[model samples]
Target: MIIPKNIEELASYAEKGKNVFFFTADWCGDCSFIKPQMPEIEADFPQFNFIQVDRDQYIDVAAEWSIFGIPSFVVTNDGEELGRLVNKNRKTKEEISGFLKMVEG
Candidate 1:
């Protein structure tokens, strides 16, 4: 997974191919809890490129995307939003997988 340094890199990722933007924050408990399980999710879904974006670092971007929750996952391709799994609560691996399935469908 690529950790985008700036908005330009983030845009480039979405503009090129299927990408999943993971919105998180360093202090978010839910984000930290799911961090360990991301590897398995990434391995299970190889078709989409996953990128982590720190909400604190990219406040403007997060705001523009209307991401008010930590550990939000937004799927996009060619700059168009395909689907999203966003909430203020903690997410399980199954829930994440289900969201991907919905997006893929």
Candidate 2:
């Protein structure tokens, strides 16, 4: 997953191609639970670029996106939002894959 250096870089990613902004924090247990499965998820969906955004580090960015929860996903394609899985809950690989598939179509 690509980690944006700044909000501007993140914006550029959103404008370019299919991108999944994964909002997470180091201290978030839910985030940790899904961290191990991310590699496989990326492999399964090669078309989308996964960008890891630390919620704490990018509080302003998260706020801009209205992401109040950790371990959330915001999908974008060519600068347009496709879908989102925003909530304060634990996510499974299947759930994440389902979200990706839904947005892909």
Candidate 3:
């Protein structure tokens, strides 16, 4: 996953192609659990570019996207958002795969 340093870099990714923006924070336990499982998820969905955004590092960007929780995901294609899975709860690998499936559909 590409870790974007700022909003501009994040935007640049979506502008290039379809991408999944994963919002997370270092202090978030749920985010930590999901981190290791992301590689498999990425493998399953190779069509979409994955970008990891640290909410703490880019507070304003997270606010702009209305991502108030850790472990949130948003699918975007050329800067247009297609879907999202945003919540405060911990997510399983299955749930993450399901979200990608939804985006594929």
Candidate 4:
């Protein structure tokens, strides 16, 4: 599993290809819960890119992207957002897999 260090890395990923993103903060309980399980997700989708953005550090980026909740995900292709799973306890590997299937399709 890949957890990006900062927004620059996240954008660098976007420049390459379609990607899967996770917007999370180190202090988030839900993010902590899902961290270990991310390998399972990575094993399933080797082509997708997973990124992490610190909510506390990148509040403006989060707000600009309209991410009002923690543990949010955005899947995009060619700079267009195909789908997003925002909060709602959708922080599990299963949920992430499901979102990927829907958006990457």
Measured by lDDT, the strongest candidate is: 2
Better of 1 and 4 by TM-score: 1
For residue 49, what is the lDDT in candidate 4?
A: 69
Scanning candidate 1 in windows of ten residues, the lowest lDDT window is: 5-14
lDDT of 3 by residue, 1-105 (tens): 999766778779967698999999999999999999999999989999999998988888889999978899999988888899998999999998998898888
Q: Kindly list the per-residue Cα lDDT of model 4 for residues 2-105, writing each as its tens digit.
A: 55677786667656666776778887888888878877887788777676677777787778888888888877776778888886474778888888887767
Model 3: lDDT of residue 70: 84
Superposing all C-alpha atoms, what RMSD in Å does each candidate have to the true structure? 0.8, 0.8, 1.0, 1.9
In model 2, the Cα lDDT at residue 50 comes to 96
Lowest lDDT 10-mer window, candidate 4?
1-10
Q: In model 3, which regions exceed 4 Å deviation?
A: none
Residues 23-101, candidate 1, lDDT per residue (tens digit)?
A: 9989999999999999999999999999999999999988999999989999998888999887898999999999998
Model 3 lDDT, residue 4, Cα: 77
**Number of clashing residue pairs, candidate 2:** 0
> Residue 13: error of model 1 in Å?
1.2
| Candidate 2 lDDT by residue in tens digits, 1-105 | 999998889779979899999999999999999999999999999999999999999898899999998899999989899999999999999999999998899
TM-score for candidate 1: 0.96
Q: Model 2: clashing residue pairs?
A: none
Arranged by TM-score with the best first, the candidates are 2, 1, 3, 4
TM-score of each: 0.96, 0.96, 0.94, 0.84
Badly placed stretches (over 4 Å) of model 4 are 1-7, 88-90
In candidate 2, position 49 carries an lDDT of 93
